[model samples]
Target: MSRASLASLPATPPVLAEFDELLKMRELLLAEPDEATASAVMRRFWDICCGTTDPERVGVLEAAPQYAVLRAFFSVRWGIHLRRLETLASREILADASATDLSAASMLALENYRGIDGELDLLGESPAHNAVVLGCGPFPETLIGLQHSALVGESLTGVDRNHEAVALADAMTRRLCAPRPTVTITHADAEGVDFPAFDLVVVANGLTGKTRLLDRIHRTAPPGVRVLVRNPTLLARMLYDHVDPGPRSGWRVTERRATTALSETLLLERGEHA
Candidate 1:
């Protein structure tokens, strides 16, 4: 629909043309109405966005009004894709107590968090204590990965607003994980979590109102408590929210590293003066 503007407007950039292609592919995905076809369409979209080397191209797209519509559409679809994987994984594991196999998507997600776990290792003694992951979804891969990597200390708690997700995550973790590092999944809002109770706090990528949550943590959590926030990078900006803790956000970046091709992890602590 917005493709007409690309031709009519004066000197439309290549990125705007790419945006038109993305919209067309989105419509194709809708017409197909199947996961395989949808996945193929999205892969093309991903390649187009990810292949762009210039930051200005992304900036151009972000400045366009179509960016909001495209982001809202793709973000929701991405969540749906993940929920599908999570649902499949949960069903299999729940059907058989001994089943441990997870979806490829789930495995890749675990791998991503494994990178974050290594970044946590850089935080010295911070991640060695109690840890909590906010907005852990149906799979809770981050929590499971941390426990498996031995990054968590006495306890690991996952908080999700969805009751169903909490139940599924709790069951999956209990069935799969060992008992040494106690794991608990609870239904709660990210903003209401007791940030001071844990030495390490992880903010999941999908968590909304991150500014408000970070503000709460900054105002409430102790100085030594470290916050690990997941942020999107490159083309991931289309599907995930970017967390920018500016100089005045009362938090300082301790470590920043890419956890995956599309995502990065940021370790933060209270600023020296804040």
Candidate 2:
């Protein structure tokens, strides 16, 4: 049997008492030979951790050991690469925002670190860039970053499915990004939208559900257009699947980092041939 299977042979306690239940969950994942069964168990573990059955909450796995271990195992089985990119992104946002100076809830949201800032940075760097932002939420920080970049001069157009989010993004631009480069936010589904010629595009969250968006981008993007994706796990998955080389076709990936309190931001861009 594989090492993972051996580890799953029986529930064994690690030194951390708090992680005992997590170990049991790992054992279950290991023992299951069926891919579907293992996936279901992993889903259940995340649902319990996130306090909801919604798959979106699976993002909570960043803090849950059971989910983390299962995620590692799944990555190996599926030939995926795993990186703590989101963890890093959250740290940078908090650091930039001085989240430690804020309340607990605010810290939590910032710490969630979904790669919004890094995406913004890419969008900001590409003037006259046509971009699509998936899972663009109500947070104004992303727009703020874009505005700051534009102040020095950068033109960008953005699309999102959430009308409210689009409106908020537009409002943020007017308030924070005014008197400079142009920015437009519109409501459109990521998978179905008509993309224009752009130097760079970004997909923030929606890793699992948004892979299809890549096809849409490819169809509309000009040759040699740059694409930046934030999800580390998805990046790993793409690499493992041998989808295509990136960072060379003008595609690149960068990771954001922060302190233990997740109150600082750092970016590391990885280059690979596409």
Candidate 3:
């Protein structure tokens, strides 16, 4: 579906009201950020965008003049919350003996990764000998999950734009994996990375400019290499970026799997035609 057009048409009153209320809720959540309160607030936000039968709700909201400002506000706040939650959870996991005491958010992420892993298995793709995860945020949940499931056999490299996130993830990997760390965290933009070096590429939902990245991958990655892209679905479109890797320059969509209420995974493979 096409994104809602941001034309000269005035936004409906109801839509403006809904946007106002959402902003109020976001401000409240940002002020306090209590765990229970954050959960409730996020659920309400998701339901307003996703739960209703009116598919146009998301479009209407996005078409509004304030949409860009509101989206930035929501994205920044959500990113902060996720980083804080994951940082605490990562510390606990590293300290714990069994390394199983995961926060609810981390556990949910692992479940999503497992679902993606299953999708790969169904396609006979499995994990590649050398895999790279783009935008592997401060937590590096995707890398950790791959290690936990033994999906990756050789080595895993995590690329992130932020220097602080890269350092934190590097440190976490050393202690979290112990004697022999298979994961290497690096700071780099997706466009600057050498895609041809890796057989598998996993794109994080938080990464923007997805089409550009896909274009780079298609132009560089060798045939038979697999790519897993995490994208938002339904009204969750307001929260994350989504891509349709249709028959493109040299990429074909092998499978699409809905992993959770908010996210879906697209499996694409580099084809011979460029």
Model 1, 1-274: lDDT tens per residue?
3546534545435658877687777667657667788866766776776687577777877888777767878887776676666656675667785576444335545565457556666566644678888988887777777888777779999999988788889887887788968999989999987677787888998887788888888877776888889888876788877889978888889788877667778888887433
Residue-by-residue lDDT tens digits, candidate 3, 1-274? 1124322335548746877677678567758777888867875776676554355666766677767756766676666655665666566666666554234336644555456555455346365777899988777767776766566678889999888778767766765553332789988998787787787899988787898888888778776778888888765666667787665446787778877667778888777544
> Candidate 1, overall lDDT?
0.76
In order, candidate lDDTs are 0.76, 0.46, 0.70
Specify the poorest-scoring 10-residue window by lDDT in model 1: 101-110
Give per-residue CA lDDT, model 2, range 115-215, as digits (tens): 44544454344463444445454444444455455422455566666565566556545544565557677677677665565555655533344445565
How high is the lDDT of residue 140 in model 1? 75
Candidate 2 is scored at a TM of: 0.47
User: Which one wins by TM-score: 2 or 3?
Assistant: 3
Alpha-carbon shift of residue 74 in model 3 (angstroms): 1.6
Q: For this target, which candidate reaches the highest lDDT against the unseen true structure?
A: 1
TM-scores for candidates 1 onward, in order: 0.84, 0.47, 0.78
Specify the highest-TM-score model's number: 1
Look at candidate 2 and tell me the lDDT of residue 31. Answer: 75
Q: Model 2 clash tally?
A: 8
